[model samples]
Target: MSAAEVSVRRRRGSFGRLFASEVHLVFGRRRNQVGLLVLFGLVTMLGVALKVSAMRHPGDRGGDLFSLVAGNGVFLGFAGLTIEIALFLPLAVSVLAGDAVAGEANLGTLRYLLVAPVGRGRLLVVKACALGVGALTGAVLVALAGVLVGVLLFGAGPLITLSGSQIGLGDGLLRLLLAALYVAVGLAALGMIGLFISTLTEQPIAATVATAMVSTLLWILDAVPQLDWLHPWLLVDRWSAFIDLLRDPVFTDRMVTGLWVDIAYGAVFLFAAWLRFRVKDITS
Candidate 1:
């Protein structure tokens, strides 16, 4: 068509290429692959253990959510997610987000990337989006692996809700997907915080550790009885809100609050990352 239209198409193509390259850089690394494998392995092991426990003690119950796993395979996914959101999932996010900027700088490639035609803001956005993709991928994999293992070991059917109600397989699977998405949103918000930390340091390891510590610290603060007043504001406070999805009526209040909290955290930290990177000198 017109010259302007051609230029617009070219720009879109360039951005798509850049984003694809970033995704490759994040997932193509051997370490990231191993991290994902570890996550899957852990979830699978949990499912197997639950199966053995059910065989040994058919009448015994484990815990609130876990107790349902032996009877209905769908609960394994929920239980796996609960265990993951406590630490493993956030650690996965930290690894990717912390390396988004600091890893490139450590390799002395940050300056070279800046020399290209791409603006710093655009590059940062691409990096953030890539981190989000990585986070979602990890969360979804855990849930899926849990479901597969649980179904094979225990068999799938209707899910027993916490309120002594039952839901069909279709509706239960849908809730599992929603729980995975909810957890992914929280991990994405944590990734943004890691992105901001990555902007401040050249050591990717340090950034990774620091970002993980932020989550751990929040969890510790949230666990304190005296801090109950401040619990509502902590990023990690409502991480387990996905459990509400298993209820009969499906409690939306906590999940909605958690979603907004995640959004606010993501917006604030992403802006901080942008503002810092906008002015920082590229010495590498």
Candidate 2:
């Protein structure tokens, strides 16, 4: 074989190795899988309750099945991503991100990987990206399950928002897609916070639990009436701002501001994580 052919094969193998490692590390995780199962069960229970209620109240009025599933309930059930992220996504992201370095550090395998000539920053980047992907996956699964449950309980039809605006079937579907993408962005910051917390402790549980507690407590504080002044700046409070999509006029002003706030937080959290990472010493 020519020398060029051998080099080409070597690079291909490296890429595959990296990709496979990420997949295995994510899916092989017992916590990730268990968390998903629990979410699915919750959705099933909610769907059954909805179905029973609808049967009991035939006099109720609202949009058709399609609209009910994809539109009204999705928005009204802001819990779709909003409440889920507050109560659960953080826990899932924390488990993965919290273990990113600390898990390896605890097991003594991080040292060998570092000695393989890879830069610390590069390793951190790969690990962070992997954890973020895991988090996004969990969020999407919950969204899909919730939408499905909502549809079965209600009928499918055009979606009507509280703003009195109507979105056609196609538009509603696309909006759902956008909503999913936005959710990933929101969770990405939390993942970084977890990653940063992980670097400070050798115990994986400490980092994971701390990230969930800190984010949730701050989110509650942002909701407190007396703390209205701090709402705009709170990382968790801004996520619900996407509900502007449901507005009749689709308020671009507030939407744009909310998005920018999310971007700013993403930047701030990532920078903070990286800063701590650069200073952390794993050589010990």
Which lDDT tens digits does candidate 2 get at residues 123-237?
Answer: 7777777876876787677667766766655545676765666877566656665565666767777777788887887778888889888788877998799999988777777
What is the C-alpha local distance difference test score of each model?
0.91, 0.69
**Residue 23 lDDT in model 1?**
98
The 10-residue segment with the lowest total lDDT in model 1 = 61-70
The lowest-lDDT stretch of 10 consecutive residues in candidate 2 is 64-73
Query: Per-residue lDDT for 153 in model 2?
Result: 57
Q: What C-alpha lDDT does candidate 2 achieve relative to the native structure?
A: 0.69
Q: CA shift at 219, candidate 2, in angstroms?
A: 1.2
The candidate maximizing TM-score is: 1
Model 1 segments more than 4 A misplaced: none
Write the residue-wise lDDT of candidate 1 on 84-197 in tens digits.
887899999999977899999999988888888888999999999999999899989999988998898889999988877889999999999999999999999999999999
